[model samples]
Target: MVAPLSAWPWENLGNFKYLLCGPLAVKVFHSWNYEGTIEDHWCLHVLLICALRGLIHQLWSSYGNMLFLTRNRRIIQQGIDFKQIDGEWNWDNFIILQALLASMACLIFPSLNSLPLWNTKGFITLLLLHVAVSEPSYYWFHRFLHESNLFNHYHSLHHSSPVPHPFTAVHATFLEHLVLCIVIGIPMAGSITMGYGSTSMIYGYFAIFDFLRCLGHSNVEVVPHELFNKLPFLRYLLYTPTYHSLHHTQMGTNFCLFMPLFDAMGGTLNSNSWQMHKKISSDSGKNGRVPDFVFLAHVVDITSAMHVPFVFRSFSSVPFSTRIFILPLWPFTFLFMLVMWAWSKAFLLTFYNLRGYLHQTWVIPRFGFQYFLPFAMEGINKRIEDAILRADRIGVKVISLAALNKNEALNGGGTLFVEKHPNLKVRVVHGNTLTAAVILNEIPKDVEEVFLTGATSKLGRAIALHLCRRRVRVLMLTLSTERFQKIQREAPMDCQNYLVQVTKYQAAQNCKTWIVGKWITPRQQNWAPSGTHFHQFVVPPILAFRRDCTYGDLAAMRLPDDVEGLGSCEYTMERGVVHACHAGGVVHQLEGWTHHEVGAIDVDRIDLVWEAAMKHGLRPVSSG
Candidate 1:
């Protein structure tokens, strides 16, 4: 009834194909059109259905199948051929099996996704469960396979690539993949099935699972550790590139696939993950050790060790002038430093000498600011003098004040008076007492400028205050420590806005003696008061002075070989009695002089006497 089978549209076409083809084509043609219209449509629909099915089968077999084919080159090559068939039950097959099971659970219990227990709870609890169940099971099994006895047969293929690429994720033994999949799948399926809920939630959960699984296998370096780790919940969810790459390089460690928390807690986590991040952050190009604060500390320690000996050796050679001037070119700061160092050096030298025992046992003790004091004072004095000279050159009135004793004056009566000049003036002041009242009464009101010399008495302090109150600029020159201390104490509060103080010390060994006068000693002097030979100890000057006197009077004074015929001289003839000598005395006449004066003898023949004394082992007496 369907119109002769050969005459119908489908039948005509089939008969024509059968007539022109071989027996196999004939068989296919006959099998293709065996029924009527309803049957034909059904047959056509089935053929169409089979064609669609073939397309999907090709995609799965070719594309999807390559993921598993990663294990062996021959297998992958064989997989490309449509006709060639090879079967191997690899780990990837097992994972697929487990994934199918999980997919089935989702399909069967779609409502599990909407269940309040699964949908409403915090993400942390879910993440914890994911890690607690999956990582330990995988880690223990992985470790078992890596044992010496089993590794060759069961684990060698997995590590063949050394650094597993994305494709390599699926390359494993059948049993191994099966075990991993089941371990991961059972918990996931159970969680979803037991917590069944709405369809939308179920779909959402699967979507998320698929997305994450694909991301885990991807090779992109997109995520940052700070973003991943800092999040309280997501830290367990995301696996950064550092995390997965470490797993590939360091087998058996970093076993958790989805979460890092499990590996960290189980002590199986590779520290290389975090370390790599740190290295990258530091911009270290190679796998070199990271340079941290601790590294810097080590460098400092080594540097200090290498240079310490040299630093100590050269310390004494540095001059006081260099120390003082170079250390503090900083403004106003050097003032406090200069004062402190001078005070300390003076104290140390005094204490050492007074103890009466020294053989240059040690170098001088240096303190903060102490090193710079001598030179700083020089620089400050120079700057002050330069200012004064410039003012003098510009025709500004320059005033000078000197304190004098009333009895020594050339005039018959004593009086505080000022000396006048075309552009400068000098003043001599005599105080009845070292009190503020005498100073106030004696200082002239007309004097807009003043200079105080020999200002080592209480009278100097009084005079300083009186001049300060009168709005006069004052410069104080003194040698007394007590007076220096007093002026320093009061000058800050007193109205003396422009007060300058200067003091000086006599050098003791090849050193300058400024301030009052130079104490010249004959070169024959042997020992210092401390019992140390004169050549053994070095004493730096602790004082300040004007530019002219600093170099000319103090620094330039050379020691002479003899005191005889030089000028009027006082000496101790013996340790017991003092004697006087003048330029008229012959060098040979001073035989009775004490060992101290004997040591001071300037005669060229004195060496013979010293040699004789040494032969007799006579101790020098009253060394000055």
Candidate 2:
């Protein structure tokens, strides 16, 4: 299928400077019968254009992310919590898909041989027609997918990115991709049918096509509402980044592709979507800066998602018409309240900046931290994905999960999240390495033997092993001897003498100190005896956090002034109690160390103290 240089679409397509830059070697011959021109310079030309589009998209997405991470308000600009985002990417999305699909389209469709690229009215109408027809088609198609069971099977993967990115726009099912291809093909097919063929038009249409898709999925809002307000119909012409972001967050609303008209007419547009758009847009330009690292937290539900305000608890027992007024309407009222609560959460939700006592900032990537807990446990995987996605969207360089987030995410410590979202640009930290350093370093010099709880758990095992290695006596406790025996079997022989056991912590009067593990919190045991010291690895805000029976028994512990950024607050919005698991995660990410010791459960894997501090971009506490 070799064609002479004179027969090629070259001059008819007018001039594209980029295409002209490459070599014109028509000396090559083709042998594939009909699959386009295999060895032709035209194929090389098409592949180059696809490559150019990809490079542009990557740059665009990265620049937008830079604005989100460094320009916007750390907390408030980050729409959803970090865990609410689902994240995954691969080379196929970055290059292979675009190139393969574009090449296939080039061979099958009436492309470069058509007309010159610059028919202002012709190609513009083609792009608009593509959007116009694709909008309703996509809306109904997408909404139907969600309303039906097809979501979990196929559509769910695209929805997985609750915080969308340009690359994420094409990350969909094969069927969805086919539908999208047809939707895009509609205008091109129409143009050819209407007797309008231009190589420039086809290339122009696709470049615009990929650009719009990428813009819609970007983290930064490129089209502000002010533009819509000024022009009015522009809203029908353009969809901002926030517009698509809302679709991902609400999931049940904003289903249109290129514009909001379809969603508005269909009544699925979220009520608060506009307000969120305004808020995020207002934080643009000079107001859009963020830091290198910030704590992104979740709104953390201490109660049920379907629950009413706790202040209304006493109202349940009230006698207002008592049974007459409250009893009958209770079910109806409950439904109404549930609807309103969900509405408010959906529309009004905003992440806040969590400031430390030292004025350092932490980004709350989510509204509530409990998305992975209680009845919502079924969707823990999706919730975790959403959080990471949101963090990446806001340009958060590093994020640390708190409380239940850590519980569900730290299976292999931070390895689970790292493995799940390997392509995410932002760093995922457990924040445990620093916590371990603080607790271990504070092992009071006078103490000879230390009492430890939950020896079988990850944190407990690590602490016990580290203590034993340091030649400090560790009184390990467990519900049964089986786990203890396992630990004994795995321990180095010389370390056995440093490990002991006690039937009850109350009876260990000889050891006034204790190291409380996360697992121990749920055990409901009294690890805190009167006149004792506790090194708590779990956040103090946890409801299960226990206090010594003798009010003044447990001693107060503080992070050395150097790492004052870490520790719990008792009065001024208590934040930062060192959790060994979270600390270890921070260390692993900061040091760029590869420690998959989660299964092995070893504290030695944690690089704490001065070494961690040196790399943390913060000064160490005065060496005293």
Candidate 3:
């Protein structure tokens, strides 16, 4: 019963490693021994393969059923009355049928198992024939299952979860899996028999295919888009996450398991699948949303790119005389357009301010006349002062003027002069000393003080002269280091005794007592005094006087007081303790006083100060 050594491929121990590890390993493993045979090796391999398949099928099916049960329980507890169980089936009946078929194939046909067909040229032909028919055949039939009615009946059960987990792959009904396998397997089996095939090649092919199919179904995002897109030719040779994820969303598209070429050609490829892929990738931190600036830049770039035609069309549309007229006037036209646009923006801002302050709503249409002529009426100053006083009662201490540069009456320093202070019964005079004198002469005798900010400048100094002549106690607060030095140089020595440099923060703390005046410098340095003793009054814009005096003359001058208990008798004393405690600079406290004491404070003014502080990079509380 001893067969020749040639009959057994592994009898040669010298080639053992080659036989086990080489391409022929599958062939050697599947070879059957006819003489004194210990059963055909092919039967052992088939049994092992079927057992592994059954084990995987059982595990996945059990897990999927558990998931279904949990979801059903949640639905019932939520008071939902209806539920659908679409893919439930009898697994035992399907297993019995499969067992019977396998028994008939293996036990009844022993001759089929004994073929020498595995070693011959027939094996090569059979392998090629099987792969060629199996791949396309499976693709087409799978596509048919995705048709509307068919998907609802069978395929939708598989797509119930948009994000398919590992268990979902084998979670379909037994009948569905069986139908798919038979549809694919029948063509493959027929090709093998028709080509005089061996069982080893067929088994090897199935093992590789199934392993890849398992990988495709696994919830792993390993493959990259660039590589996937690059392999246009071999793209059909494998299944990707993109392909499977799309199948879960738009169930009808991308029906093939291994090949995508069929789906692409059939016009069933989901257009939005790539967007979903990008979203998933971004959610996983692989990509991110586009920045707003970059998006805006792209829009601008596109618009600019399209503007060339419009420019060319404009040149072609005009007559010769019209073209000549336009060519010379276009620059001025552009300038005029710019001016108008600027005016429009200012008008809108002023309208927004009036609407916000008066109506507590931004109803621009209701205040059309005010917007068109911002400072047209004469009594607006009185009304504004009344409004400011009402606002001060509510603890608001700033007023904003939404004056555009184009408004003639409100332009430059005139804007400040138009603001009325009811508490002082005076109108503010802005500009250098000359304009201040003119405004001062116009003020009624009842006005007591003229608060002058920006007094460090030549204009502010001149205004101070006029206020002094009028016997007004002119308080000038300043932030400018150079201007402060200049004011010391230019100011009459006797006039210096009346000047007080206090910060806004100190002013607020001492709001119970003293009134603050206009700031002469920038707001960086603190100058206001704090405590409960003094009632504060802010300088009204205009100061009235009964008589005029020279710049060097003392107009109703008073000597400085020498209080023994006070820390410093000198008016210009620099105390670190006072400076550190006062946060609001001299300018803000002075401006706050004008609005606070004059009763000109409004919500709009407070909002403006808040916004301005923020714009200048100050950390103020947001009001709106």
Candidate 4:
């Protein structure tokens, strides 16, 4: 059944919904420019209050989803899915609507515009009115909405989230929010019409209302159990997060707005609310689950820094790209980046479940540019080593070094950690074995000769060695003959002839297949024939200079269909797809391999890793 109030007029506006305030903004600026009375400046206060409300909600969300602080006490252990994210993306829309309504009220009522900054009597009146009127009204109206017809048509939209985030507080149908506006506005309206209202009373009441709503739905229990035990009656007066969580989980009970006193009075309080609150609040370190696998990665750039799950849920759910709205946040994010570079250590970013095992992603405090700095190498490797040791101490099954975390020049592809700490129980993996397999499998079976760049690097060596075994000719590009001969000698006696050294890009002019493990300029890419597809394992993938030739993405794999609770994308890869190395670490944990898959990749296991990944439902991402 479609509800009459299910759709909003600005629902289709997306980020453009902010433009609805444009007229008020212009009016406020014009009034200020002309030195108009406080009555003419009243819209400024409404707009300021709206902006503060939005900030409060955003802070609550970021703090709630920071698992490092709240994971143990979190009432809901599951990740927030994309559907809930999209539904709640515009949670602040009501703030703008309320601002407009307030503006209209100011124009109609001359007294509301000339209110004093503070009034002790008005503040007391607001509190009493909230208790006598707003509380009871909301308790019964909420119960009415829960009735079958109303719940199905409108209220179900809010209850659809199995896990309640801070934004979930405002996630409701237009009718539901319109009712909420009245319930909230009554006390402030009563104080104003009674001639006792002030600027602070309106601002103070709205702030408290927004704060309490966010607190109830935060899903992280922060109310100390001792406080309730000491006071005994505070539980009825102040509803904890656990109390509201029960309403979402067991919908028939605990239907009060912010206080459980109304629920007790209505005989709708859940019997288990107090018990659940105490349990979640008392939980600590020993009760937490250690992750099965940890993918240790670092921020790639300034834009990628905002791609964490808590920053912007909708943006983080899909592949990352710089958007116009994100530009406003650049200054703050840049300062955060500098602080992380100077003082931060490895920290948890986000997590998901894979076949009942917990997998988490952790961020190294350094950025991609710092890895190439001569002085920063020691610092970067120290961070990786410390992370590996910490994972071993915590019983983590496998820890994978991502991107530049495994750079050979920096840490020898995670070998330094394994060698330095030989007694460690956790398996350290660079995950390049499967990376090689993914790149090799992309080539057509009939292709005879291919041009290879970065031919002597780790992946380049493995790819060349594997292809030569299939009797495919490889024109290995490198200026150093010694490094080329070293990789060539590793190949079998008969296949050694299949590996040929070339010092220049022009040598590959006739070759139609190009395998690039290193960056290539447009001048170098132009050497390939018209239809030569570029298959690369390069970081910050090479530019697509030629429209005539296709460019392959960095080797990646789609997670198994059964993967659960995956809510965020991995860097630029689409949802459910991850870099090949990250997938390799997952394969290691799934297969229960005892050996650490670090250092140089074993060319012999290229096919073995591929088969194991396939057996476990990991599909190679299409190069196209």
Select the stronger candidate by lDDT from 1 and 3.
Answer: 3
Q: Rank by lDDT, highest first.
A: 4, 2, 3, 1
Task: Give the lDDT of residue 383 in candidate 2.
Answer: 53
- Candidate 2: C-alpha RMSD to true structure equals 23.0
Q: Highest TM-score: which candidate?
A: 4
How much is 348 displaced in model 1, in angstroms? 77
Q: What ordering of candidates by TM-score runs from best to worst?
A: 4, 2, 3, 1
Cα error, candidate 3, residue 476 (Å): 80
Give the total clashing residue pairs for model 2.
56
Task: Estimate every model's Cα lDDT from 0 to 1.
Answer: 0.34, 0.53, 0.37, 0.90
Candidate 2 lDDT over 1-624, as tens digits, reads 422221222323433433442322222223235545554445555655666676656655445443324345222234322222223333123344344565566567644443564666667667667767867888899888795567767777777655566657876665666577777778876776666656677667777778888887776665666876688877755777787787777789888877788888999888876787777777665534433343434333222211111112112112112233345545655564455445332111112232221112232223354354456543553455565676577675665554445553334544676677667776766555454555566676667888776566666676777778788888887766878877766668999878776667564555667676643442444545555555555533223344542111111222333342121231112122223333444445455554332234445545443366545543222111
Query: C-alpha displacement of 381 in model 2, angstroms?
Result: 44
Task: Please write out the lDDT profile of model 1 over residues 1-624, one tens digit for every residue.
Answer: 321211212223432432221332333455565532232122222233234433333232233222212211111111111011111112123223443444454356545323453354333333444567765677677767778756776666666643222334555565565575566554445454455333334334434443444344333333554564576567555665456666656676876666776677778877667666444434322222111100000001111211111121121122112243333434433453345335332110000010111100101112223223555443323332333333334332221111111222221112211221122221111212211221233334565544443444333454555456566665555566576666656655656455656442111222221111122233312111222111110112212222222221111111122211111001112211111111101111112222111111122223443333233323232221
* Per-residue accuracy of model 3 over 1-624 as CA lDDT, tens digit each: 432221223323532423232322243344543344435554454555555554454433333223112221111111100011112212222333343354456566565566554645555665455456665666677777677876666666666543343334554544466675574466446654665556655555555555455445544433454554576566555566556766765676777766666677678777765555444434443222211100000001111211111122122112112333245545654464345334332111100011112101000111213433545433333333343343343333333321221123433333433443335322222212212222333334554554444554434455555445445555555666566555555546666544444333433332222222232222311232222111111111122121221111101111112101111111111211111001122113323335221111221233344333234332311101
Please tell me which predicted candidate would have the highest lDDT against the true structure.
4
- Quote the positional error of residue 141 for candidate 1 in Å: 2.7
lDDT of 2 at 143: 88
Give the Cα-based TM-score of candidate 4 against the true structure: 0.97
Residue 400 lDDT in model 4?
90
Q: After TM-score superposition, what is the CA distance of residue 516 in candidate 4 from its true location, in Å?
A: 1.2
